[model samples]
Target chain A: MTLVDEIKKRSVHVDAAIDELLPVVRPEELYKASRYLVDSGGKRLRPAVLILAAEATGSELKSVLPAAVAVELVHNFTLIHDDIMDKDELRRGKPAVHMIWGEAGAILAGDTLYSKAFEILSKVENEPARILKCMDVLSKTCTEICEGQWLDMDFEKREKVSKAEYIEMVEKKTSVLYAAAAKIGALLGGASDEIAEALSEYGRFIGIGFQMYDDVLDMVTPEEVLGKVRGSDLMEGKHTLIVIDAFEKGVKLDIFGKGEATQEETDEAVRILTECGSIDYVKDLAISYINEGKAKLDALCDCPEKELLLQIADYMISRNY
Target chain B: MTLVDEIKKRSVHVDAAIDELLPVVRPEELYKASRYLVDSGGKRLRPAVLILAAEATGSELKSVLPAAVAVELVHNFTLIHDDIMDKDELRRGKPAVHMIWGEAGAILAGDTLYSKAFEILSKVENEPARILKCMDVLSKTCTEICEGQWLDMDFEKREKVSKAEYIEMVEKKTSVLYAAAAKIGALLGGASDEIAEALSEYGRFIGIGFQMYDDVLDMVTPEEVLGKVRGSDLMEGKHTLIVIDAFEKGVKLDIFGKGEATQEETDEAVRILTECGSIDYVKDLAISYINEGKAKLDALCDCPEKELLLQIADYMISRNY
Candidate 1:
């Protein structure tokens, strides 16, 4: 079976687990808002990747279900809050949590999911030391993600943001959770420190590549597929890697950060970005990171699961959006 | 020392510890907004309660400093987000974080502080089992706090909320953190489970009484003292125990939830509440809870710290605001 089909088969289990675990609380709107995006559905990629990582280490997949659900909840928590912060009106082709439930509802929903993630993580049925270690890893990653988010917002206001700064932000905001997921998966699967570290590095590089491809998709993907405005980041003057690279090449885009830009102006901006080869430059960087991610998997035993992990990395750079 | 003086002395240590641990992140606004309420200052009651609880169990105060700081940070985080959700303009005599930093900034600042609190909690120098236990207690409390906040917000839209329902909401929203702080401090300080549970009960009861007193203060305190609009809860139609009791007493409040009511009308509403004996009824209940809280201290050994914890319970009911 193809990697996508394998992922789909595994995601069915992950989705069912999450559905059962999603909080059922009084004052139903809070739980409803929290579950909204989860129900609307996406690839469930984080949990799928996690289960695959655990299985690759020759461990039982069922034992790692709680951690898998916990990571995905954290991911969704970030998305709910990020949408509110970005003031985006749609997610997964439905009204964003904030747009539907209002900002206060969205904030509470996100917070509930966040705290629930840790609560769920605490129940992972591990040794006390390992449980504490997992909590520490997840907590530190959470801190980094929040800091990275602040930097993303901070970048929008600043005149210059280096590629290094952009990469660090993406690593913190986008990649650290993935890194932790793989590391924690290995740890839960009883892998040695060396193997866990290798898997973590793989996830980290792949995460960065996934985000780079996301940056490219923002410029190239249509609004219908993307679920919101195609170039909302550019309109917000976010110094994504593409924007930073374009500025370095002396290719100034008219619509960068201009909230009032017309569709024609945004199209022109995308056209300029494409002509200046910034999009291709970002795609190349994404490919390189995916390659680096796949290389880390060489430490694991040669198995079908390991091959799937490699295919997953390639899929990161190759996806349309 | 007088109970107030003891609290003052303990608060100095808590404040200083917090000052040192507060995140000094880039995008200075997030940190600034977070520290804003902390810097402007009020009673560091939560951490002091934690330390007092530890001391009551004959535990070293120094060892639980990280836990103390963690609880305080979580308190401030709730304040930041709660202010935004409530749309209150002032906190601790300064513009609320959202007013100064914008909602997005405030949300991020609150989130940064929330994540930072757990990060700090993980650093507590305790046995792995104890630390993990603390994390579990803290995580569960965090979840309750979010749920309670949602309920508080939800209560604003609904009529006929019961006193029992209001108590549960306050327990989750206001008291659980206090309960967790005391319990975790006891565990960290090497107290037995029985002692920790007793201390947690004490904190929980005191927390309820404290909120009851706060509800009373909203009517009696002037704006300068409360650092918010007087009767803001009433203006928002929050069915505090006072409101519920007033209704039971056949005292219909003309200014209740009338956001446009003149100051004279609100003052008249307060006068009627006082005249109908509803405020006094709520005050009696607050004192009862405080008395019950003090009773929990009977389980601990006789010591000055235990005496002080009893005095602290009394102080909770007697505070002006």
Candidate 2:
């Protein structure tokens, strides 16, 4: 199948897996909280890549579905908790779990999803080794995600952050799990350790590109299309690459903007960022990183799935909406 | 050894184990939040029992300590998350994680402990099977606890709850982990299934007695001693056996003296319970459960450490403060 067709098919498979896998225990708080997050309508991109990557390696058996589904569940679990932490209002164009159910329920719902991820994982019969590996990866990813959040929280209080530091944060926050998605799939298909490592690197690159592009969207998209603030990243004083570059450029240009700008002036500051070509710098950085990611995929020799991996990588960098 | 001395030795052991296990991560959030919970001087009773139970079974080899510590970490994980969900304030004479750090930090901290539990368990180099089984029991126990929380939330919205219904809640909320703890220790020591099952039953009954004693404490200890609520279960209109009996007797006396009291008023109407010997009834009921729990312990024939188990059971019923 073509890359577009592959993603569409994998998306459908993952959606079905989620529908089948989420058991409603009491049909009340546990299930209701789960449904609240599950129905929020995520891209389901991680799981799609999981199943497709597994298939691309060799087999297209139904056995890959559980880990694929678990990835999606893990993704949503992080989102529910992240939304509560970020105090975000809208998810998939509707009220966030916490906003709708209070911080308490949002927390409970996120926890339920966390436990449920294991519940789904523990049930996958074959590939116990792979599942264990995935669990380790997932658990490590969770810890890494927490660390990234701590750094993000700390950024608001600090003055200067380097480009390398920004890359490290995004790699932890975004790329690790994305890397795990493809890596876990390769493990499921009995791929070689070298090949698996390459897939992980591939994910790491795309994850950075994906997050960088998201930052671009924050600055450039219209409010209605974005479903929240345009330049909300700036308003929140997020130390994303664009903002980081803009600040450095601003300093080089004798700009006194170190930190602690008022929220009301966020856009004005972001406007300064665009005027300084800070936005362009961020964009260029994303392209190079994405190209390096594609280069890593190209370096995965003797893998029949290489072309498919390349197509998916191209699509990730180019995606919109 | 006397019960007090046994508890002291076990407390020192588990406390040290917890101390060692917490620093497995370098980032401060995981360790700080862990210390926040552990340093609360929580009596370390659960892990204490786990160690003593393991000792009573045969070996206090270094292997069991991680399992012992893992259970405690799991317990704290549940508490941190549950407190956030329940919006609780003071725990062990200090502000809850959510209260001090806000809901987000508390949630991440709780998740970190869950991760830390596995990390500690993964360190059991002497008996890897025990570690895996311990994790299995813990993961499953956590899942049940989540279900119980859901039911508790559901019961808050319901008008009537039966005694049988309340017992089932106690099983899920309080007893299962105790059961698992004893069974895990025995299994780790290579105890026969029959022995493990019997000890597990011992743990379960003792757990019931422990919770029942707690319920009785709700009636007698007053809020000042507990550092929170005296009759909180009553105030929350929780359908504990105490309030369930109050409902029965209140209905019997047609004591609509207030002409249709709210559940809150009815809960407060436990004064009416005092007049009608309902508190006495509660005390007697708890005593019977303690007796039943002790009887189950007694039925475990031919054990050298039976005295210790029996002593622990006795302590389960009679301890105050």
Candidate 3:
């Protein structure tokens, strides 16, 4: 099967598991709000990473499906809260949870998903020691994720952010969950500690690359294809790596942080970034990170699932929008 | 010792454990914001319950201290989030976390505390199976707390809420954490399942009474003693059992849900509710629940710690604030 087909084959199980594990029960409105953003369309990249990591370790997908679902729930929970924090109104082409349910409702919805993630993970059929280890990994990752978001918001208020600070923020905010996914999948599949640690590194590297490439896409992708305004992050003054690199190169883009730009102005800014090599700089860095992530798979035996995992890492930067 | 002194004796250790287990690290401001309300002087009742249950089950204080700290953190986490959702400006006689750190900061802070709770709980030295069980209990309790909060916000929009519905909300919102605390302490302390379950029931009953009496104290206590506006719940139109009973008896409360009421108006409403026996009815009901909770302690052998647990139940309703 193609990479997308392999991912979908596993993700369909994740979708079915979500319904069975997290049903819309009492206080129907709350459950509905909690399920709102979760059910909306998004590529199930995180779950796919988890399932592939487990399969690469010679485990069946069914054995680690709940852990995959738990990781996905954690991802959605962060999105719901992050949208409220960033005041983003749309997610996955739908109104953010806070927009539909109001902030209080959205807060509760996110909180519910947060707890349910743990609740579901604890029920996974595994040795208690392994399950406890996964719980530890997931919880610590969540704490790091919170720290990352704090750094992200903190960076936005300041006039300058070093590349090191930006990468640290990205690692914490976006990458740790992926690390947790791979590590958790490996642990549940009864991989050795060394293999689990390597899988976690694989996830961490690729997750960073994925986020960096996302910044590149935000600058270059068209409005219709991106599903939101192109270059919106630049207007919002977000300190993505591309912006930091361009600023270092002394590239003058008048529309940066202006909150709005005409199409021509946006085009001009993109052209300036391209000429400065800042855009390509980020693209090259993202590729290097993805390559580093794929290198971690050397610990795994030769298997079709390992090849699929390598392909997923490439897909992280290769997918346009 | 008096019940106050007894609880303080145990709570002191919990206070120390909090400092050790949840220290201010990198992202100093975020950790500071998370620690703000936690270090504030609320009576450490939940931790007291956990430690006391552990002691009653022949466990040493040092062994279960982290679990006690974990429960305390979860309580503070809920308070931080609930303050934002309720728009209550003050908590523990100071500004809420949101007031100091902004809503986004408060949200992240609460989320940090939440993951830290699970992270800390998972590290307690114990059998992995028992620790995993506690994780399940704690996570499920958290989900129930969210449901309870949702029900509370849902009730505010409606004109009437039945006693059953109010009890259910209270059980989920206010009591489940207490239940988890007692159960976790017992499990970690090596108690039998039957004994652990009884202690959980003990916590559940007293917690319900604690909240019910809290409503009564809101009416009868002076502002200086209560440390918040007396009858604020009334003005805010909270559907406490006292209000539900008063409404059932055709006692028209003019100041109810008025958002503000003069002292005279508050006093008049208090007198009307008193005369109709709604206040006394709730007071008696709270006492009965506490009694039921104390009765659950019969499962334990007679010991000083068990005696204290029973006294703690009585103190739930008897304390002025």
Best-fitting candidate, scored by TM-score: 3
lDDT of 1 by residue, A1-321 (tens): 888899988888778877777756676778888888877878877787788888988676777788888899899999999999888788877889998889999999999988888888888877777777778888888878888898888887799999999999999999998898888888887788899899999999999999999999888888888876888889888999999999999987787888757788888998899999999999999999999999999889998888888888888977876
Best by lDDT: 3
For every model in order, the TM-score on chain A comes to 0.97, 0.90, 0.98
Count of backbone clashes, every candidate in sequence = 0, 0, 0
Q: What DockQ does candidate 1 score?
A: 0.75
The Cα local distance difference test for each model comes to 0.87, 0.71, 0.93
**TM-score of the B chain in each candidate versus the native B chain:** 0.97, 0.88, 0.98
Q: Give the fraction of reference interface contacts each candidate recovers.
A: 0.73, 0.28, 0.95
Instruction: List the candidate 3 regions with Cα displacement exceeding 4 Å.
Output: none
lDDT of 2 by residue, A174-203 (tens): 888888888888788777888778878888
- iRMS per model in Å: 1.0, 2.6, 0.3
Cα RMSD, model 2: 4.5
Best by DockQ: 3
lDDT at position A3, candidate 1:
86
Write down the lDDT that model 3 would get. Answer: 0.93
Model 1: residues with Cα > 4 Å off, grouped in runs? A260-267, B260-263
Better of 1 and 3 by lDDT: 3
Individual DockQ of the candidates? 0.75, 0.37, 0.96
